[model samples]
Target: MNWQSIKEQLITFLKDEVKKTGLTKVTVGLSGGLDSAVVSVLCKEAFGENLKCVLLPSQYSSDGSIEHAKEVCEKFDISYEIVEIAPLVNAYLPNMEHNKLRIGNFSARMRMSVLYDISARDSSLVVGTSNKSELLLGYGTIFGDIACAINPIGELYKSDEFDFARFLEIPESILNKKPSADLWEGQSDEEELGYSYKELDDALKLLVDEKRTKEDLVKFGFNSELIELIDYRIKSNAFKGKLPTIAKIQWS
Candidate 1:
């Protein structure tokens, strides 16, 4: 919330993370969305010119998103590259059965794969762009955008993330734009989730983080059926947050 203090801490946080991983630079996938924009700026403040922004776009990616990503990178003097993943994704689609969900998942994974490749080439860690709202609501792909060497904004909610964006003085264009994963054409994150962030975060605060039950949520003005639905989603997707489960045997 405090820009002065958060700025100081972020610089130190990024420095420590880079040191721990023995990387002098950091890379982030800039989606032209608020979360990635915030991450890019934070990494810039921390790592300076050592931060690189990669725009891994596919056919579903909008031109507006790409231009905005480039604009932000230029503003901060961070190096950037726009890599089109459409060809790569299309090349692989033929060999695999394709569906909307499958293609969406593939898009996420392909973006990650490109990021890791660049990370290895540049000796930088891939910085994550997920926020608390997305993480708690199971709104991200497991090993895709969800994967990162270190995340500075993952703890902030979608609303809180926008607060930090203002603190970092992000461009209004990015700030005011709709939130999207850009995995498919014309897909907005909120539209897909069937709720706005304001509503979702409020519910998540009571339901997931606060450990409230359906009745408790109903008391807090949430619909009983909706609470149950959210509860089911969170529990069912809990596996995504954990490392692969392993079977254990009784030991002597």
Candidate 2:
């Protein structure tokens, strides 16, 4: 995929986008995962000392996640801050009958809320870490991890994100770990999605990028069940990729 060339372009995009916003600095929520790590390195290359990595861990965050986030910051010699959002989340959703998904979504929003506030305080923009696969399938929390001023990796698939992360020499610990939002203990992204990113990304390429039909996908030996699931996800979650819909009314 010519990761080196792509990486250079993303770095340029980051720098140019931040400048367009009249902001010289950027803040990212480092989740101790491949996507955030890749974005961190790219922003570091783009903004140098102007990039700030904020680790917003909730109660569900793993200890290893926090440590790995710190390692990335230290490895890149980038500025960082650790803000615990558990207290804030608890205060907001206390005494509620929320399930894992609900609590997880709330936590995601809380973390993003902190990131935006930090961006305002630091006079920086929020650089997103969501990859194309997640965005395509609507696998992220709306107005949460999906919120950002500029997304350098949103166009790359999950598999491509890992490839780019490795090219950037992200810590092996992060690259090797199972992908997760760290929304709760014992939670894994693939487990929740019921498919590995490789499988999903492969299908996505055929369906979205190549504009293949269901019949064509079946001819390619793709499972009908998986195809339907992926198709539904793409259609249903398409809203996550667009602006809010508004109805137009005739004026007198």
Which predicted model would earn the best TM-score?
2
Q: Candidate 2 on 35-67: residue-level lDDT in tens? A: 999999999998899998999888889999999
Output the lDDT of residue 244, model 1.
Answer: 91
Clashing pairs in 1: none
Residue-wise lDDT of candidate 1 within 1-252, one digit each (tens)?
586787678668888988997769999999888999888888887888898899988987887889889889888888999889999899878766767677888889999999999999998899898888887778889898898888887667897677778888899889898898888888898888887888777888877678777788888788766677577778887787788989999999
Error of 2 at 47 (Å): 0.5
Candidate 2, residue 118: how far the Cα is off, in Å? 0.6
Residue 68 in model 2: lDDT:
98
**Which sections of candidate 1 miss by over 4 Å?**
95-98, 249-252
Give lDDT for model 2.
0.91
* Winner by lDDT: 2
Question: What residue runs in model 2 are displaced by over 4 Å at the alpha carbon?
Answer: none
TM-score of each: 0.93, 0.98
| Model 1 per-residue lDDT at 146 | 91
Error of 1 at 111 (Å): 0.8
